[model samples]
Target: MPSSDAPSIRPRRLRSTPAMRRLVAETRLHPAELVLPLFVREGIDAPRELQAMPGVRQHTVDSLRRISAEAAAAGLGGVMLFGVPAVRDARGSGIDDPDGILNVATRAVQQEVGDALVVQTDLCLDEFTDHGHCGVLAGDGSVDNDATLERYRSAAVAQADAGAAMLGLSGMMDGQVAAVRDALDAAGHADTAILAYAAKYASAFYGPFREAVDSQLTGDRRSYQQDPANRREGLREAELDLAEGADVLMVKPAMSYLDVLADVAATSPVPVWAYQVSGEAAMIEAASANGWIDREAAIHESLISIRRAGADAILSYFALEVAERLR
Candidate 1:
C-alpha cells in the first residue's frame, strides 16, 4: 500500500512474536555458562540465612554438600566456595590448614560432584583474618604484598591438595597469579587451574558481601582493590594476569563493570567470567519483594546483559535457580 518513497525495510517483523524474537536472539543463556557462589560457615548446626541477601545462606558443611550436589544436578558450570571459620587469627592460619572449613568443604563438594562440575575455592585471607584484610599486615598495619604472596603460595598448595579444580586468586595483590602458578606447579599441582579476579573494583556494591561472609573489616580496601573510576586499569590487570598464567580472568560486580569485562573478553585467550556481586543481587531481590519488578524476568535480563557484554561465564547467586529453569 506504500508508495515508492515510503520505507519498506521492517526490523519489527523479527520482534513481532516471542518465538520470532527468540529465534533471532543474539545472546542465549545456557546452564553451562553459569557458576554459583556459595558460603559455608564452620561450626554451624544449620544454614544461617543472610539478612541482606534474601534467599542466600551461610550454609553448614552438610548443607553445602547437598546444595553442591543440587548445583551439579542442575548442570551448572561450577560452584565457588567461601568458608567462614569460627576462629580468626591475624595471620589467617586457617586458610591453608587441611582441617580448615574451606579445605574440608572443598574436599566434600569435589567428592560429591566428581567431575560433574568444577569446584573452585576462594584463595584469599579476608574470610579467615580477624582484621578482615585480604593479606597479612605489616608492623605499620599496611598490607605486606610480598609477605601475602608467601601466604598465597601456601594456600594455593593447600587448596590444590584439597581437590579444588580451580583457585580463584581474588586478593588483587601484585604478582599473585604468577606466584600462585609457580607454587601450584612446584607443589605438583600443575593441572590445577587459576581463575584470577583481574578487575575487582572497590565498589559500594560489596556492602552486602561483607555481611554474607561476616567480614571484620574496619577500613576500606582501596589500597589493594582497583579504584572504580579507572577503566583502563581493568584491562591492564587482565593482561598482567593472563601473562602470569591465568586460565580464567574475572571482572567482579558484573553488571557495573561490563565495559571492563567486554574489554578483557575481546583479547584474552582464556575464559572470561564475571561476578554478579551481593549488592547487585540484593537490589533485584528487594525490588522483586516490593513488587516493583518481575523477579524472574529481571534476573534473566541481568544475566543476559552480562553475557552479552562478553562474559563467557557468570558467577551469580542466581546460578542454581537459573540453571534449573534453563533445563
Candidate 2:
C-alpha cells in the first residue's frame, strides 16, 4: 500500500452530499430531453386504460388534445402519437388518408399545443394493416421491402400535411429513412424531421406495445428487426440511418440495451435516443404494484441510468409523470 504523502485522491468527495453530487454530475436529465408516446384509438369517445400498461390509455381525440396540452405545460420535449384505426386493409389505406385517425389526432394536438411542444406521429403501417406486419407482403408471403418503402413515402407526406412536426420511422424496413426523407423533400416538407428507430431489435419487450396498439401480428419481427445478440450490427444500422439523413437515431427497449445505446451515442453524428418500451414499463409497474419496489424511486433511477449511459433523449411511457414531478 502507499506512502501517506502520496496524494490522496478520493472520488467519493463528489458523492458526499446532494449539492456536491449535483455540482459534479456528469449527466443530467431534463423534461425537455424526454418525449411522451401517446396512443389514440379511433371510435373511442373517452380514454380507455390499457390493461397491460396500467397507467397508460388509448385516448380519444379530445382526450389527446387535453393530454397534449398538459405535456406542453410540463415542458416536455415532444409527443409521439400512435393511432389505433377502427379498420385495417391490405394496403393500410388509413395511413395515407387525410382523415385517418392518426392524421386527425396530429392536427388536433398541433392545434392544442402549437410550437410549445413538437407534435410527432408514428409513420408505420402495422397499426393500419390487416396483416399486422409493418409493411406490404409479397406473393411469397415475405415482407416486400420496396413496396413498403413506397407506402412509407406516402405515409410520411400525409403525416406532414396533417401537421406532424416530426415523423417517427419505427418500422425496421431497409431504405425507410432515405425513402421518407425524399418524399418529405419532394412535397416541400423539408423542415419535417425523421426520428429513425435505427437499431430496433426483435425482442419480446414489444409484447405490451402490440397489445396497446391492438396489433394482430402473427409472427415475430426477426425477419426485419435486428437480432438481439448482435451489437456490431446495431452500430451498422445506426450508421446507415445517419447517412440516410435521419435527424435522430434511436434504440428500442432502452433498459436492456444500454450498451447499444452508449455505443450508438459514442459514434453517432446526430442525437441518440432510447425508447423505454411498453414491456419494460409494464415490468416496473407490475413489480411496484406488488410492493416489490418503490415505484417512484425505481422509475427515477431507471431513467437516470439511461441518461447517464449517453441517451441524449428518451421516449418513455413515464414521460408525463416524470415531467410533472420535475415541474
Index of the highest-lDDT prediction: 1
If scored against the real structure, what TM-score would every candidate get? Answer: 0.99, 0.96
Assess each prediction's global lDDT (C-alpha) against the native.
0.96, 0.93
Candidate 1 Cα errors over 4 Å, as ranges: none
| Residues 1-327, model 1: lDDT tens digits | 778897678999999999999999999999989999999999989999999999899998899999999999999999999999999999999999999999999999999995899999999999999999999999999999999999999999999999999999999999999999999999999999999999999989989999988999999899999999999999999999999999999999799898999999999999899999999999999999999999999999999999999999999999999999999
lDDT of 2 by residue, 260-297 (tens): 99999999889999999998899999999999999999
Q: Identify the runs in model 2 with alpha carbons over 4 angstroms from their true place.
A: 1-7
lDDT of prediction 1: 0.96
TM-score of 1: 0.99
